[model samples]
Target: MLHLILPSDLDALRELLDENPESLLDVAAVVNCLGTCGLCERRFVPVAPLVESLEPLYGDSKGLHALLRHNQYISLSEAICGFCHADPGLLNMFQKMKKL
Candidate 1:
């Protein structure tokens, strides 16, 4: 049961990174701090490699062009297609505002 970070969480993290440029390490630390029951925690997965792997895949012909066209490669999971994640909270909020 990987407690995946919601879209809002990612957005918040991005904003945090922007605000405290020196806290880049802290940002990584927080992202790696998954809950005890999640797949990330169980597997002890480090986010560094994941972030590295997504760098080159963000550009064209990488199969993620559509999803990451506007977003820089900030993290691995962030590079994932929004449609694939289908975050419930984000979708619900968008629906309420008629923005979906």
Candidate 2:
């Protein structure tokens, strides 16, 4: 649970799956799960405490706000490493690639 890793032995995949945060099998069983639940909605979780603490060091609230504002999915990454919303970030990048 503390860490996840896949071993070299192909037969040992089951054990690795067991330790995996998101199981490859029976994925739908994960309820309110950040990884695969399509219906689950994301609430705005703040990534402020760390920056706020360091804010006094920088003494630049405006700059900090500007930096944090664009990365609205900060908490999403901090909370669940792989869980990301399908939003303008992905679509925008794809659109740019298409243009290129």
Candidate 3:
């Protein structure tokens, strides 16, 4: 299983932070995976640049923690993962809309 970071994931993470202030720990846990599939045990190449880029978007560690605790963030993560894994068409549509 490929484990590339998706823009939707970032957006979801951001939305999550916006909705709550205590989800940072959860977000950190997810980020720590570093491309290893939790279920399949498949090892994917780590995208360091992608991860680095996300760091600033969340501001500080505290900010990230808040996001993790946010309900919206959790929901967004589920939606993003569903789109990425089961509905690429939906993801593409969302990306296209963002371009406009």
Candidate 4:
């Protein structure tokens, strides 16, 4: 399935890479896993400090090489939605927050 929000244009992709080097690994990893994963809309969070600490790597290289160089689980899932057995109270709270 095509990513609804992610750009399909090469220049747009490059622009995104240039604008936010910190997102390099995350973008690369997601692109690499595209069309292969079952949960296409799944969201993930970095382990923190990992992406922030990748500036030196960004200066050296700018692809998956720089992205996945560190031996850290940066883009691992912090939370996920759209699943079975969700907590009703939590969902209610989210809905209420949306109304505020």
TM-score of each: 0.22, 0.28, 0.25, 0.28
Q: Total clashing residue pairs per candidate?
A: 0, 0, 11, 0
lDDT by residue (49-99, candidate 2, tens digit) is 434533443355565444444443433333322123345565455456557
What is the C-alpha local distance difference test score of each model?
Answer: 0.34, 0.38, 0.41, 0.41
Off by over 4 Å in 4: 22-62, 67-100
**Per-model root-mean-square deviation over C-alphas:** 15.3, 15.0, 14.8, 12.3
Highest lDDT: give the candidate number. 3
Worst 10 residues of 3 by lDDT: 70-79
lDDT of 3: 0.41
Error of 4 at 13 (Å): 0.5
- Which residues of candidate 3, in runs, are more than 4 Å off? 1-9, 32-53, 56-100
Residue 63 lDDT in model 2?
54
TM-score of candidate 1 against the unseen true structure: 0.22
Candidates 1 and 3 compared: the better one by TM-score is 3
Which tens-of-lDDT digit does each residue in 24-51 have in candidate 3? 4333345653244322333332323223
**Of candidates 4 and 3, the better by lDDT:** 3
Worst 10 residues of 2 by lDDT: 25-34
List pairs with backbone clashes in candidate 2.
none
Candidate 3: residue 57 lDDT (0-100): 64
> What does candidate 1's lDDT look like per residue over 6-76, in tens digits?
12354454454345433333333445532121112222222334344333322222433223233322223
Reference-based TM-score, model 3? 0.25
